[model samples]
Target chain A: MSQHARGQRPEAAPFTERTPRVVAARHLTRRQGRDKAGRFLVEGAQAVREALAWQGGQVHELFVTETAAERNPELLQEASNAGIRISEVTDKAADSLSETVTPQGLIAVCDAVPQPLDTALQGTPRLVAVLYGVSDPGNAGTVTRVADAAGADAVIFASDTVDPHNGKCVRASTGSLFHLPIARSRDAAEVFAACRTAGLRLVAADGYAKQDLVEASAKGELKQPTAWVFGSEAHGLPDDVVASLDTSLKVPLYGAAESLNLATAAAVCLYASARDQRS
Target chain B: MSQHARGQRPEAAPFTERTPRVVAARHLTRRQGRDKAGRFLVEGAQAVREALAWQGGQVHELFVTETAAERNPELLQEASNAGIRISEVTDKAADSLSETVTPQGLIAVCDAVPQPLDTALQGTPRLVAVLYGVSDPGNAGTVTRVADAAGADAVIFASDTVDPHNGKCVRASTGSLFHLPIARSRDAAEVFAACRTAGLRLVAADGYAKQDLVEASAKGELKQPTAWVFGSEAHGLPDDVVASLDTSLKVPLYGAAESLNLATAAAVCLYASARDQRS
Candidate 1:
């Protein structure tokens, strides 16, 4: 074992608000900087812990405040043992690296967490979520978390969806972002075709669809491999997109609600498929 | 019928930002003001419309800007026909009444929405949602919407649960607030007892439950009338609260997610009851 204790003492000089590296990390809050740098910032202890545990994730650096360092000593020790550069920072510097009102005082610079669609769907994907035009970062991240909970194989973000690396999305995901494979594409049609070729039936969660979850379940359509496609909450899947799918089914609204939230609908559809497929 | 023309002409002088009535209406945004006045503000067109439609709701006043009036002439006419007071207000006055960044140019003051717990759980209720200490307005409201969508008979806001009349909660409910019965109480045990007396079984969605949804389903537990009790997402049902419930079952997590969001889990649980009961 190495003689020097890891994460035993804070860095001799903690990073200040004016630190250039900390300043650079702040830009990851925006999409342009994240895309160009091929990296993003993961804030809060839970997400940072997930990033550190994910074998495929490259957590290059960790920024922590004195209070946070004490609060999460085990996580810091883990990061130190993994050879990740641990930088001590002042509260102001921690604030600079966070987008939330109350920063959890921990952040990690990670490689973008997405891979190619083909790579994500390589094997037989029994349950997958394809978010098309899901622009809300919170909804997108919530869906990612829901998909993971449903035992989904992968989540494909296609065509104008919010960047999965967005801070709000990551926070809303509550560490589920790092738990599963994520893939992105600009061409939604190609993504749908790829899903079909992978032997997963495309089922869009359309609000206006004639068939509901019960009917789909009755027909035994939900038991098969399915890639559940969801669109924006404001606008359901585009007519052209819905037309191209194998079929579309609506989450039944038994009461007076006109429609379900995008994440809510996705949870219902994905869990339905999960229940039937597992049964 | 003798009126010159309904909603055809704007008031001679629209209420200014400093108008006393407009100033008074803004106070409804706060809990203290809302509680003191026994009234709350419902913003946006959809909610205002729902308030207009609800037989139980008394839409006391309607505030509208010129632009919104022009856009929704029919809604104004409907309000006019309903004998509700229509107050034309300046854009500045409308802005003063809204909490959202983009005001929908419509706001309605209505009576507080909660009723007695016994009244909410009245009748042979097949399904219901009991939110205990769910303080997040968004989560509580979304659960209310989900409960409505699943055709639950009522939603009981138990104990320290957020006031369902909170502006964010009302907006998040997307007008479902007016579609169903809502009950509130400071005593959670009373709420549980009332639910049990109503012939509804209490099922808590616990993350650490040894019994999963599959086992619960296989045991024919879900087929009966049930009141699904959910707690806050951050801290689940308190130990004492969970211990008092009939039984607790967790949504089976097929993937790596630690837990589902409160609303997501509620949707899955409520819809499961809907499925079995309907079948």
Candidate 2:
């Protein structure tokens, strides 16, 4: 380590290593990387800020561009003061490291994983969102944000869905990613079983369901501790998942358009249940 | 123009006079390109396919990479049979012409716009959506698609809103851009005037509105000839817009999350109104 490296000005090369260890850490690619490390990269200034605000000490490292640090000095200072490692990278390096364009030049490595299904059901969770096979990272992120806004107790991402830790998903969550508990499982049947054990009612949202969402959410009609299952737009909920549910609900369509986008449908259902629970 | 000059393969020259003309023709930077000329660009194959299925004759030109044409000969034949001008470009050219990564090697120049508001209001339109200051092209597009599915008679894009003809918006609409009538106007005042003239009730959707959506719709309180207004998530409907409405409705939220995304809220309200109308 050199004095020049430690006391160098903003534009000057600072760390002694030339390459910070955190910045040089191996990139995670497979599910094993996520499961083994218990950490994933959350990119963008807004998302990283939300993670810091919500999870605080849970963040392992912060990588930021010089421009981002200059733009948000307080954030950089906070990270440094909290004993979190910080590294400055070139714009090109940040771009290469980021998953989306216009990355906002900051990224955080943070700890997050699927919580146990029982933990989500422990409370009187009248509203829950179950996402099945939603592979688009942005849509998944939006659903998480929507679920949080609607005050759902938790969100369950079922099999074959995009990793919720993906950078795009974090950005699309608009900061809600940090505020909600999320559980991921390969088998939705297990989720149903947990709901059954917890004395929760399960409702599946289908385009052809006989009951309208309003009717399904009427007082005393929707069993308390409810879990609402939403499926991908291209394919409705898996037949088995649908069959396992106690009731099915639909948002009636007035026009000939095939269906609402998956996130929009989930928002509708989540808000409906939220309304019912509140009133 | 001589056949040699007109038919010179796009590949033979690095820059062709026709190339700029074609690119300019497909660009929507000018209002005349979308209005007087009644043409807008649809980038990517999935979007082009949706446009073709919904408004085939409205497509004036088809641009494709050789690879894309080889893979989708049926699409090529459909364009050719419809007398749409076809031009082949290199993958680089396609990339340059597209806004999305992985351009899908195809784009279409089409002619279409929102249907007249009056015509769309026929047959007792129970639900309508108004978008104010929603500058995000993708959000505007998703709203259009949702309005189509919810069977809303028309969508009004008020002041400061993004152009519905933006390529991303068109692509997001997934062909519903052609199915629904969307009107772009100066502000809420004009929208209010239009609604009043048409004998429709105006219901503005606000986060703090007193009435809950389900209650408003379930009671047949906001039934027939209704217009539902949604504002940007950043700056909600202007004070004037909120004050002049017949009623203001909110989607009840049960959590600490700030608010629902603009498009998501609109979809819920529209679907609620659709359900009310159906019953």
Candidate 3:
């Protein structure tokens, strides 16, 4: 790390898509490289700021196009203060690094924030969102965001679920992905075991369940430290999986609409618990 | 209408991209075409069934891959009984007709189900969801589905909002588009005028509002014939729009989430009013 005067780090030559950092960032788009390298790409200013804010300086390098450097002096200032390595990248290179249709001209390579299921269970989690075989990256991200907003203790994504650091999930999370601990279990059995050992009640967010969310919450059932399990939007929890859970809660639908989607259902279920717990 | 024997409609020629109906279905991929033709493409078996079941016979034609025809003989028999023109398409042609990554092998050409604001207002409205400048087609569709599930009378989309028939919205609606009345207003002002004329209360789903959804439901404020107005996920109802509404309701966040996305917020808000009105 070279020490330079404030606002005086000499601009390095712009790198193309072939440059090591840009190549690395693009490769992080795939799970293989991400797992091997133990890092993923964080795009946009807000996500970058949050990634940098994560304890222990996870962001190793920042890539900025010349236009972004000129337009976003503040982000550069933040990077400088955080002692992050900054490099100038070609416009085309920045475009390649971003997964969005419109590149933000900035991207950061940050360490993947994955915790072992046991690690997440160490602290008695009051409220947790367990995603089992939830394949959609967007739903996975939104649920993480909702769980974070509801001030849940953690989110556990089963190994069969979409990668938590997938670009689409990160984008939908809108920086909330960095706000909480994320755990991955190899299977639903691992998650079930974890919650049991942690002494947390397991409640399934089932559309077909007999108990209504509001009714259950009003009766003081939701105030307990609980782990709320959700599955793919198309399918609720599997029969075997549900049988293992302590209880199943359904958000009562008053209209002709059949059921709420995965992300929305999780929001309602978690927020009910959140409100009840807070009150 | 062709008077064909039961299950005996002559197999029409395979439609190339240039063929009239295929071109029309493909044209529906654009907003202009959907408006000009006054029809849209409804894909998948579930959506096709819903469109056919819609009153006044909105579905005019059905296209099927040979595989789907063999696998879903009952759907074809039902289509024939309903007097729908069914055509067999090549796998490539079926692929062309679908916008999804995996073509569902069934597509129905149905009339765009937009009702006049007056028409929506004419009915004794109990519940409705209005989307203003919501550009995301998926969100628009999901909200419409949620509104329908909550048994809302109608779903309204402001002119600037994404077309309800847009491929993404239709896909996300999970066929709910055919299950209810959809009204499009030239602007939010027009929506306001319609609601006032219909003597319905307007409640904006605002994040910053002081009122909590549960409290409002408990007090019976949500039981009135109401129109729930939502805006783009990026921004809530505009200040001027909020000033015109009867009141605003916020789904209380006990979690750390700053606010819910457009789809999730509409679900919680609509259901709160729905539960109150019903119970």
- Which of the numbered candidates is closest to the native, going by highest TM-score? 1
- For all predictions, the C-alpha RMSD in Å is 2.9, 5.5, 3.5
List clashing residue pairs in candidate 3: A149-B255, A149-B256, A149-B257, A150-B255, A151-B256, A255-B149, A255-B150, A255-B151, A257-B149
User: In candidate 2, which residue pairs clash?
Assistant: none
Q: For each candidate, what TM-score against the reference? A: 0.95, 0.81, 0.91
Q: Is the docking of candidate 2 incorrect, acceptable, medium or high quality?
A: medium
Cα lDDT of model 2 by residue, B191-265, tens digit? 778777777899889988888876776677856768988888788888887998898998866665677787788
Best by DockQ: 1
What lDDT is obtained when candidate 1 is compared to the true structure?
0.89
lDDT for each candidate structure: 0.89, 0.73, 0.82
DockQ for all models: 0.85, 0.56, 0.50
For A140-183, candidate 3 gives per-residue lDDT tens digits of 99999888878888899974889988999999887777878888
Q: After superposition, which runs of candidate 3 have C-alpha atoms over 4 Å from their true positions?
A: A1-8, A24-27, A118-124, B1-7, B24-27, B92-96, B214-220
User: TM-score order of candidates, best first?
Assistant: 1, 3, 2
Query: Residue B263 of model 1: what lDDT?
Result: 95
Candidate 2 or 1, higher TM-score? 1
